[model samples]
Target: MDANEQETDREIVPERLFQSDSNTCASVCGAEQTIRKDFLDMLRERHDIERHTRWYDIKKKFESDPRYRIVDSLYREEYFEDYLHIMKEEKRKERELREQRERERHRERKADRRDRDKDKEKDKDKEKSRKDRGRSRSRDKDRERKSSKEKEKPKEEKGKSEKIKKRETPEEGEHREESDKEERAGSVDSEVARQRENEAEQKQKEREKKLRAEQSIREREKEVQRTLAGHLRDRDKEREHHMREECIGHFTALLTDLVRTPDFTWKEVKRQLRKDHRWELIETLDREDRERKFNEHIDNLMKKKRERFREMLDEISTLQLTSTWKEIRKLIKEDPRYLKYNSDKGEREFRDYIKDKTMTAKTSLRELLQECKFITHKSSDLIKENPNHLKEIQDILKNDKRYLVLDHMEDERNTIVLGFLEELNKRGPPPPPTASESTRRNK
Candidate 1:
């Protein structure tokens, strides 16, 4: 029984240990998750992490915060990297969606324009066909009128001959009959000549009218042709512009991370780009334009690099408003960002950083003083009334973190406060509302 109890105790002891271990692990994981959540929240609230932001920069920027320090370094870096990737993917999707929308809108507008042009062409053709049909009807009517007149004229001539025959006596001489026949023949010839003259006049009028109609139609066609030519020219210009922009975009895209650096020369970059199929896209661009764009790209790359270097300097824990480049350089000499510029340039940038830092500190301190309920527009008068009031105000400001940032510059801080007081005094207090103004506002 003792041996059996000993074995059972051993088993129970191991089981308890296993349970305790599992609980500890669960608690640790829960705490880690909570810390990670807090850190991410802080990042979301304060930091605008972009694609270009580096891990080193983020670490230096947030290392002082409690939330950032709670998470393990490896986990923090992993989370940050994952967040950056997610953000970049989201931005890329958004950009693609916008471009797709723009392209769809362009296609819709183009289709609408084509439909309108087709409708206009159909309307013009309909109007032209209607005018042609009307002209044909008018021509048919004129022909019928002329034919009826010709038929009636012959009938009248026949009737006149019959009447003359009725007037003739049987005993008339042959010479008289011959003379009458000659007169009849002359009259018939004159009448036929008059009919021919009228027909010639009518033909001349129709020809002139036809020529005028043809001239108007030709003028309209020529105008339409000119308008079409103009539209074609404008369309070609727009197409060329779009092509040029697309080519430039393709050329810019060809500049990968390897070639997009301040260190890369235009000649070297051009050689590398020529090997790529995208080079053909910029064939329409001149050598000068290509070189110019290359130079601009380099300039932008250098500018971004310089800005990142400045941000690194801003985040350096060892850096101070009073720190010199010589001291600061020693601390950052091992950093890769430090090697980007020579000593002289780095010194100049450090000086600028210090100057900007001092200004920011001063501004923050001033704001703190302004926020104090003790300080007012009439602070100057109060100080004059009781010199202890100024000391009290200074004591109140010294407790704030912002005031400590510029505590070394006592005179500057005092000057800022005095200047603010002066400004407030000059502005003066707002006037009280009159009876009329109050009544109007109530209404």
Candidate 2:
């Protein structure tokens, strides 16, 4: 049993130790390879833990083997890497959004600050104005008080009661005296009121009389103003009538020109026509007519005048009036002053008579020329046989005092030539015109 057996045991133990070392190294290599393979799978798979995990099994596995720590650690590392990157991007976006919101809030605050400052400035100005108004109002009140005080005066007379008041008197005595004074004051006040009533009655009567006088004066003034206004209006109407007469004269001249030359402006013709014939006082007054029959009478007179004048112009055109002029001259030669004079006047009257006839002939001749163009051409033939008649016709055209008659010849019924003759017959023979017929014709 001894040394050889101990050496054999030692050799066997060395062999066993070598074999165990080899086996342990092989197991460690296999475990490391398995762990590496699992790490690669975890990386590739990127496992989800939040939704798919069963809590009980996971707890059991952790409690049973604690090797779940390795898988969990691996999973957490991958999970944290991707999740942390996403969280960082979300944080950056949130920061940008918050910055934008902050910028908007800052602008709103600035605008609100400006508005508040403006309102505050306005309020400050208003407060300053109100304070100034208060000071000015106080000054005005003081001035009014001073003016009132200055206007009050002290009385000069002192009564018996005032004299008595300066002496010391008993209270009962003072009361009895005061009652007596009050009774006396009441009696005096009644007397004063009676006097005032009498005075007021007299004053009222005077005032009433004065008011009646003033009313009468005002009525007289109103009557005068109304009469004056009527007179002034009548004067204005007379002036307008004169102006219309002048314008009508111009219109008649233009019409005569237009008849001579047809190329005249109708616009001017219409304007002159409207100015001359568009208005009449009767038509204007017709609106306010209180007497219909009077208005009708005036209207009838005007209508007759217009109708007669128009009819006569039509007759002159139709009758070829030049033949009558020839007959009138022959009759005038037979009896020189038969229709012209009474011989009571001198040659001056005879000249006036010839001038009047010549004027009538000129106006009648113009009407003949305008209305009877064919007759005027035929009348020219009479000049060859009757040289005297031609001389008279030339006198009527050039040196006759006919322009004056032309003024009134516009209305045959209202011709001034006939009106003057009627008026002259009513008066007697008048003096002839001093100027020559040529000067009268020029006028």
Candidate 3:
């Protein structure tokens, strides 16, 4: 490279150090004096004095002139190179860590395989030892049987000799009887006769006692049996009485239910009554009374069902899909707070109605109406453009509770819109749309 090119290569990048208020180049230059000539010689000779300091002076001088801006541009490319180097180091570190984890997994699998092989070898050795021990035990049993046969022959010969000696032995006896002997014999006979008489008497007494005791026990058993029979009869009668009362109570309740419904067949009602007497009595009620009760019951059910239907409708209305601003405006006019409907309130009311509960639609409708109050113009416009955008608007409205109450009224359900004309007719004519019309601008 030539001297000029070498000088350019060592050039420094300048920063925005000068305040806008001051333009005196002399004072600014004092902070970072620049080299006038032989910049390459200064760079080569100044190996120890911070190279950045010398470059800083060059940077300050070059920064003042717009023509030197291109030279300043090169510094950014170098700075980017440094950042790239740092990123490469980080990537290398991550790769090494992943490789280390893979090595550990490989080592674990190898060690487990080796352990399995060791266990297999140990089992083979144990099986061999068991077979050898079984063979040795069979040979010892054969030797023991041979020794026992030799000992049995000597034992049988000894037993025969002893029996012959016993047969050859003779007995000796004296035939004379002394007075003492006779007296002793008579005493023995007398003692034995007394013992026989005593035994007979004891047996006879025990038999008589046993017979008497048996007769008394039999009589007592008969008495107990009679008492038990009477108690059982009383218990049966009590159970029958309780059963009859339960039957009567059930029939009475069923009869009242049957009387309130004209369509209730006499045969069917009697079955519910669960008694022949109740069935027969129900068939005799006056036709006029039966009809009145039946009409009253039907009216009550219809009124309840109508209320439930209204609640379900309110819930269904709250389930809006994404709607455009124009659609929202129309919905608002029909029901001013319609866009503000609470999905929770609508869903809750729906569940209750489905479960046959009465009167929750009003609260849910009111919540929906209140939410319509907070609709921002931009969002409201967006909601109105998409006619099918009610679902999204409902979701936004349902999630926010800030619209639960309105500035003018607490109960939004009562804020009747054009859509509620049918319900409002029952009350009276609704006042002309005053503020309602203002909310409905042309798209």
Candidate 4:
């Protein structure tokens, strides 16, 4: 009976230990993992090394419903301490994981808030001109954020680790142990901070890249606008050029038709045009454009006159030498041929003919003097000579093409001949021979 009671007490001890193990796990570890820990404690308590090796089988046997019983004293104080150490270690790991998650969330919130602030700052400067905007402002923003973060760090960091360590009785070797643990935690913190910094730098680079892409697109849009403006300017210039040319053509046609009769002089016709409503048509034109049109109009008038003279071809050929220029002029006017030489251009053509004919006649007269070294001919006397002399002079004048057009301008023919004689007088006969020249010639 005594041996059986001892056996019952031993069985009751295992039952109490099982119950205590469950309570310890619930209170400290906060997990259902207490069974595995209890099994380990069982191997430690047992003196059988072979049973310790077969840990899984022992766990299966003890945890089975048939042998299950609680024993409070089965796990000693040392086993409970080991359990406490294990619980502390597991809780520390869980706390570190939770802290990591909280820190990640904190960094994410800070980054998102900073990005929003950056956008707000960008919006504030949107009203400023783009030309005056400085790219240095981005660096300024980065520096400002760094300064504010540093300014707020002491208060924020102090509150973050606000849980104070209890002042307990000192243990001899605990200082080194605590210092090593703190150092490990600091190293982990520094590594996480370095990763956050690297991520921030990557985000900043991405923002700068997006800004550059947007700026390039804006520049291309401006270039396209400038090209369109240039095309518009060219189109306006071309339209103005065509309108100017059309104005000149209309003015010239009007003048050509006006000068087909001798009833009007060009000066009178031009002066009267202002009152004739014809001048009002061109009044809108600029001064230079109107002047260009007038010049073209005179040229058209002269061409018309020249064409009319050519139509009377028979009379021009017949009266070459026989008619005095005065009668030739009258005959040309009344001969039913439309001859009008009353324009400013007609007088201009007359003067030009006179100048060219004089030049040629002078050249020939000078050569004639060279040929007849001591001739007694006087230019004035020759011009007033008889028909025979006039005929002889006419034969000489025919050789040069410059004087040929004078016949076509029959009214100016006498004036041209007189001008030719004046050019000959400008030479003043010939130079009197010098003393050395006379002596050389006599010798």
Candidate 5:
């Protein structure tokens, strides 16, 4: 910064030292002139020095000078009211003392007048009471004189009343007039001050009432705005939900159409087609509803699996007696209905179904042994003629089991037949204990 700017920054000006529109330099400079620092300092010293002075002393200072006159009203408001109250109290005391002195002087004057009247009454009694001359004539003359005095008494009293009216002192009357004027002025000033205070209080109350009303209006407006925003939000959410539901209905129709299509006989393959078409549409549902619908769709996908199993059961009895299980399996898969049951879960379900269906058809182990013994009843040389006898028995069992069976992921139901045959081979053919032994036993 430049030096001039720095100097401008450092120079200080204190506020509230003088009122703006004071008439101190009205003709010479301007009413807007600021008080000099020296005058401010002088005022500060004068305030400390004269703070204890009489109110009239400060009033004289204010009334004589134009400069102090402006500050005088401010000073009276700020500090002079206490002194004003004290001066009024002192004036009251002085006036009361002056009235007391006047009352004492009046009392003394009345006492002196009373003493002089009593002395004139004693002298008149001394001069006229002792001698009695020409009693009857004196009595008549005294009566006539008394009548004349009574006739003149009213005029003399009127003259004395006029003299007393003229004797009222001008100084005392002026004092009473001045006192009355001061009393009237004091009452008017007090009334004016009281009215101004009441007006100010009423204005403040109005301002506070207006503020409360405005605040209440603002709060109500904010509440209405929040309520409106909430309603809009709810509307938006409902719109979104409606859109989602419409999309769901459309996707469900597409799935149904895919199931009705003629190609791909397996329900699983049909579902796969539907998935390829609208898989993204199904992802928007909530968790519980989504899982429920997904399971229902899966049921639809595997719908043909049980029908295919029942068909396999019906075909089991018609298979050739010489055919192996692999040959039977090959024939079964060739059917259009078998494709849906080819999946892992479908195949497992089919196997369990077969197990349940064959439960009633299962041959007892004792009955099966007896049947094997009967089949091999002829001789040890029966092997060459019946090389595939175990296969024959297996085909018979396939018929008994209703053909819907699986073992080791293959049609290995014939292994049970082979087990029975191996048991028959280990035990040599039972000897021909025929009729000769029977006859000897009978003798």
Candidate 6:
């Protein structure tokens, strides 16, 4: 090969190698992030890791866990903090969503009530209009009858006068009688027509009134049925709630401390529970529900034992927060609470108790800083602009008993104070005045 071709080939090889290396680095980074996420998810599943949990406590608890080894030890603490932040955010969102749904339901119910009231008013107005029309029709029928009666009286008077004249003149009387007969025939036809029209109108009014009555009856029946169904649903829910509570109470009574050991099996507990008469109270519950309640009772017992052990630790005045598990094991080995678990388990609990205390101390110190009136949104910038401002704020905080909790951890205290000031600054200015308030101010 020529020297120029050889050099070109060498250059191409290095470019390919560089591209492959970049791809490999990208893949490695992606895999690392995936495992790190899995480790955080594992920590979330651990019910023992509470809001008060510390990195030291969690590390010892899950050091041997497969998922824990996925992430490097350096990143575990950072991931745990992320997990805590995610939980807090999720809880806040859930609370806000629940409140918003409640408000919407309240508004919907109010609107439904207003619509019902409006419908009732409209129905009352229609009924009143129908009654008024009926009254006016009856008045017109009375006036017609009065006018017909007056016209009949005038015809009768004319007939009397004509009869008297007929006795005097026979030919004239015959002619007058013929004309009266024609007039009477026409009056009879008119009266019959008026009677038929009145009958038809009365029948139409009666049919309409009957139809209205039937419709009202049907509507009432529907309303009654809806109310009855709602009552039945509420009753059923109440009964279910009461029965669930009774079942839980029965389980709590049956599962005593002696029966709910770490090695306790569901089979043995079921056999023992069935023999007792109190089991009848919870017999209606499904098998899965019964087992779940049984497991919950056992967990409660374990939690109470852990609390009692922590209480024992708190009562010991000689032990320091920084004491090692080996040192703590020697101090509480003879205690009954300590003996409740194995040596390793007891050490884990001691570590958790110490972390809990540290978390509580840090929380107290933060609260003290928040309550300090001298601290403001601009406090962080002010401290930077004037160094002595930091000391002055610290001296003010020193007077409070809560500040003494983290008095030895100067760096942590300063970090918390600065972090809080930064948070306040991030909040920006207060909200604008509401429209109603603005209107009131103008007035």
Per-prediction count of colliding residue pairs? 0, 0, 27, 12, 0, 0
- Candidate 6 is scored at a TM of 0.42
For model 1, state the Cα shift of residue 126 in Å.
Answer: 24
Evaluate model 4: give its TM-score.
Answer: 0.36
Q: Cα lDDT of all candidates, in order?
A: 0.82, 0.54, 0.52, 0.60, 0.59, 0.83
Q: Judged by lDDT against the true structure, how good is candidate 3?
A: 0.52
Top of the candidates by TM-score: 1
- The stretch of ten residues in a row with the least summed lDDT in candidate 4 is 48-57
Ten consecutive residues with minimal summed lDDT in candidate 5?
Answer: 31-40
Q: List where candidate 1 sits over 4 angstroms from the true fold.
A: 1-201, 264-281, 431-443
What would the per-residue lDDT of candidate 6 be over residues 314-401, giving only the tens digit for each residue? 8888776567888777888899888889977887888888888888888988888777777777887888899999889888888886
> Candidate 6, after superposition: displacement of residue 396 in Å?
16
Q: Can you write out model 4's per-residue Cα lDDT over 173-243, one digit (the tens) per residue?
A: 37746886999999999999999999999999999999999999999999999999999999999988876
- Candidates by TM-score, descending order: 1, 6, 4, 5, 2, 3
Q: What lDDT score goes with residue 398 in model 4? A: 62
> Alpha-carbon error at 330 in model 3, in Å?
30
Per-residue lDDT over 6-37 for candidate 3, one digit per residue giving the tens place of the 0 to 100 score: 77655632223343325567765653333212
RMSD to truth, every model: 18.5, 43.2, 38.1, 47.4, 46.6, 33.1
Candidate 5: tens digits of C-alpha lDDT, residues 132-228: 4456678999999999999999899678756755886877657866886899999999999999999999999999999999999999999999999
Q: Identify the superior model by lDDT, candidate 2 or candidate 3.
A: 2
Candidate 5 regions exceeding 4 Å error are 1-172, 259-296, 303-335, 343-347, 354-443
Model 3, stretches more than 4 Å misplaced?
1-189, 196-242, 253-443
